[model samples]
Target: MELKFKFAIASDLHIALPETVWDHPSRFHLVEFSIPALEVVLSHLAQLNLDFLLLPGDLTQHGEPDNHMWLTARLRQLPYPVYVIPGNHDVPTVESMDCFAPYYRQFGYKNPSRLYYDCEVLPGVHLIGLNSNQFDADDGQIGWIDRVQLDWLESVLSRVSKDKLVLVMVHHNILEHMPGQASNPLSKRYMLDNADRLCQLLHQANVKLVFTGHLHVQDIAYSDRFDLYDITTGSLVSYPHPYRVLTYERDRDAERLSIESYRVEAIPEQPNLQHFSREWMGDRSHLFMLNLLTKPPLNLPSAIASNLTPHLRYFWANIADGDAEFSFPNFPTNAKKYFEAFSDRPPADNNAILRL
Candidate 1:
């Protein structure tokens, strides 16, 4: 039998709370427009009759307790079921470790206390949420599921019905969206170190589709047997902030899965934002560069790849921060070896080029 379900997927919400609860610069994400922009998006979303909404991660400006509380309260009021997983920002960073409860509470995961678990959001639609964010020195870097979680995952997959479609949700991409696996530092710590092993598990079980957001760009990737679609939804505080609605269905023959992606642009609604509304809208064209770099998944420089993350962040901030006449240094050579997979171009999207 064929099953059809429509779900709305958006990520990197980066919700900022009221000013009294924030600290400037430290509260770097409190841009002049995210909250109001989000309000418009959520209100608009209510008009869509979606079965559910999947927010992969980064629901808060940071791991701030109040931010989590405010975001969670808002989520609870959404019109449909909402599922979430914690992003590095939503989870505790060095600055604060107490934000997970409210963050998790707002997300409504299988078990907030547990890093990973499954939720059957609808009949025959199993939503498996994985906590791919964690440190494991034994793996030589940050991010990896522990032996315990890995074993549990294997066992869980064994029980899923092959007839049902599986939609995996996580903050990091299990498959490469572009090339340099170590390119972007923001995602380095959340990528599953044992990603290949995880792939084996999902593939063997016929997990045809997976959704993810991190890197804040939009792109897609596929394996013959299965496809991994990555949508790095723009941050609420950043320019070109976006969201999308996805529909998954079986081909007429019911022999394969067909997924369609639709991009949703930002809509702002705030009085304070009127001053910088034009600025907040950002350059749609620069987003092309971001799409290019993140196409394969921030496979930035693999070595000091994480270090170079700061470099990319600074460049964007300079431009987004309204500084003109800025100069960006050449892509660091140390970072060259990491982007080998993306070094060569295949075919540009002829139809999607910006008319610069």
Candidate 2:
């Protein structure tokens, strides 16, 4: 018999109520649209007849109790089951970290005491939700999957039927979405500290798909050695606010997953949300662009970095919008080539079908 299912992924919601909304002049997130944007997406999703919805993480604006409460109440009204994990922004502190699982108990956190879980979302299909938030002695949060959870995952994978379809969800990227993402100083923080270990276990179990968020880019990265795909979705609170709908099918002959992405083009207040958000990101891109120009691999001088920053104003916004093809005919050859590498390299970012 053939097996098939449909699901949606709306990641990095950053849901904030009116009173909970805050602002920073240079912040990338236009969080004021959080609630309204989510409403728009959910309303559309309600008509899709989805089997389930996966909110990979960053569910709230900043781990506010009010925001969490608001999101939980809103999700309770949805027609399909929702599964979530904790993003660094969702549980920013040690105190908030301890309450994450219980607070979201209804959404995949079956055990109030445990932060990670594996359950059969459908017959012959299993879903694993993992907690990637960890705190240091000083209580500074880091992106990591502890040894205990790794061991638990190993045990779980060992027991799941080999023929079953397994889908893994987490808040941090398990594969590199950009060039040198795992080692680049500015980008590595968005990646799992021990991604290799997790990848090894998944590869061993033949788990092929991973859903993630937090970096806020719409990119599909593949691991050649492990034969795994990391489908990372863009944030709803960022420019070109986006979400994804995926359909999976399997039979004796072959298995395939088709991906299609959508953007929230407008909201009541912002009639041209895409235009507004793209400019919003560009207006604040100077400092960020400078960091990239001055960082390790490039290490360009301050004067040169400042000169190049203005030319790359829409660089990140383009990346966030996904499947970006880049060209800088006016830039120095080395700098031009380096920046161009950030564009979609293969297999398409926003839409494609994967054969497994």
lDDT of 2: 0.92
Model 2: per-residue Cα lDDT over 116-185, one tens digit each? 9988998889999999999878887788899899999999999999888999999999999999898998
Q: Which stretches of candidate 2 lie above 4 Å from their native place?
A: none
TM-score of each: 0.70, 0.98
lDDT of 1 by residue, 1-356 (tens): 56666677667877776662345433334444556767766776788778898888777776666777777788888878888877777664433433464356545643555767687888888888877666444533345666787788888888988777677877777765454444555445445567777777777886756667665544444554443333334355554355666555555564433333332244434444423433333322244334445545444434444444444443333322221233334555533444333322321211111110
**Which residue pairs in candidate 1 have backbone atoms (N, alpha carbon, C) closer than 3 angstroms, thus clashing?**
177-295, 177-296, 177-297, 178-296, 178-297, 180-299, 181-299, 183-299, 183-300, 183-301
Local accuracy by lDDT, each model = 0.57, 0.92
Among residues 3 or more apart in sequence or in different chains, the pairs in candidate 2 whose N, CA or C atoms overlap within 3 Å are none
Kindly report which residue stretches of model 1 are placed more than 4 angstroms away from their true locations once superposed. 20-32, 94-107, 136-141, 183-190, 224-232, 255-356
